[model samples]
Target: MSFAGFEDDIGGWGPPVELPTGSGDIVRDAMRKEQVIKEILAAQDDLRALLSRVNAVQGDVDKLASGNATLQTYIDNLTMQMAKRR
Candidate 1:
């Protein structure tokens, strides 16, 4: 008998795991381990995606900062010109 494609056998397609017969404790432990592994993999994938998004936003912030510096320089120059006109 197999649950979630994990056959309770000696030689199988997936990794050979010996499960206890009629021992609900062992079976429950295996199921919990499988669930934890799946969750960990999902979290890893999510973290990678979040990191990529953060890097992209950081690049945009750098561009915005560069533009802000250029605008500030232009404003300073305009202020000097207005003072000379007075």
Candidate 2:
């Protein structure tokens, strides 16, 4: 899950190239980058929370399925007993 070694392989890269632009333009670009990063991180957190909830729901569904199988077995046994008595 870590990209730690990739940095060494791609290291020694020159600084990012920048075209001449007004100071206001540079400030706005930096602000936009910060906002985008924040939104992306927040979205990741939301997805993690959603995954946890989905796992819990799956557990509940499994329990219900097990209970239904037990009930069906009981019903089958009862039906066979009544038939034998008659």
Candidate 3:
């Protein structure tokens, strides 16, 4: 009825068993995984901010293109008037 020679011990089980040596390594690995996840999330936020800025720049560029088109039309009209005067 005895297992490994400690059956009579108060707990009816043997003395505390030593955990496998790799137990601490398991905890460290979990911590590393969590840190990696946090870094990935921060990078995602940065990418989102960068995307927002890019979108804003695209809007400004579109406005500038429209303004340039208007200026070109105005310049062409003025050239025609000058030629007529000459």
Candidate 4:
């Protein structure tokens, strides 16, 4: 006997009805949505920049590791030659 705004017996309103215009709420909502979109775009750009930095750092790490390996191999070969001569 008291299901005035509800759709079914779940006792919950289905959805909020749109109010009459000229109340400035529509403008406010639009501005809020725009701000949120701008913030999201800015966040996305920041993430992209961070990822690029990480990739660059990874490349540097790889290069250092490769250089270290190469240097170690050369040193080992030189040491073996000196031992054979002596």
TM-score of each: 0.64, 0.68, 0.69, 0.65
Compared to the true structure, candidate 3 yields what TM-score? 0.69
RMSD of each: 11.5, 8.2, 15.7, 7.0
| Model 1 Cα lDDT, one tens digit per residue, 1-86 | 56886656646576867766645688797998899999999999999999999999999999999999999999999999999999
- On residues 6-82, what C-alpha lDDT tens digit does candidate 2 reach at each position? 65344347666576764668889898889999999999999999999999999999999999999999999999999
lDDT of every model, 2 decimals? 0.90, 0.87, 0.88, 0.88
The true-versus-predicted C-alpha distance at residue 14 of model 2, in Å, is 22
Tell me the tens digit of each residue's lDDT in model 3 across 1-86: 66685556555366786656535688887888899999999999999999999999999999999999999999999999999999
- Stretches of model 3 off by over 4 angstroms after superposition: 1-24
Q: Which candidate is the best by TM-score?
A: 3
lDDT of 1: 0.90
Model 1 segments beyond 4 Å from truth? 1-24
TM-score of 4: 0.65
Candidate 3 lDDT trough over 10 residues, lowest sum = 5-14
Model 1: worst 10 consecutive residues (lDDT sum): 5-14
Report the C-alpha lDDT of model 4 over 1-86, residue by residue, as the tens digit: 65678556462465665667644698887888899999999999999999999999999999999999999999999999999999
User: What is the lDDT, from 0 to 100, of the residue 31 in candidate 4?
Assistant: 87
Ranking by lDDT: 1, 3, 4, 2
- On TM-score, who's better, 3 or 4? 3
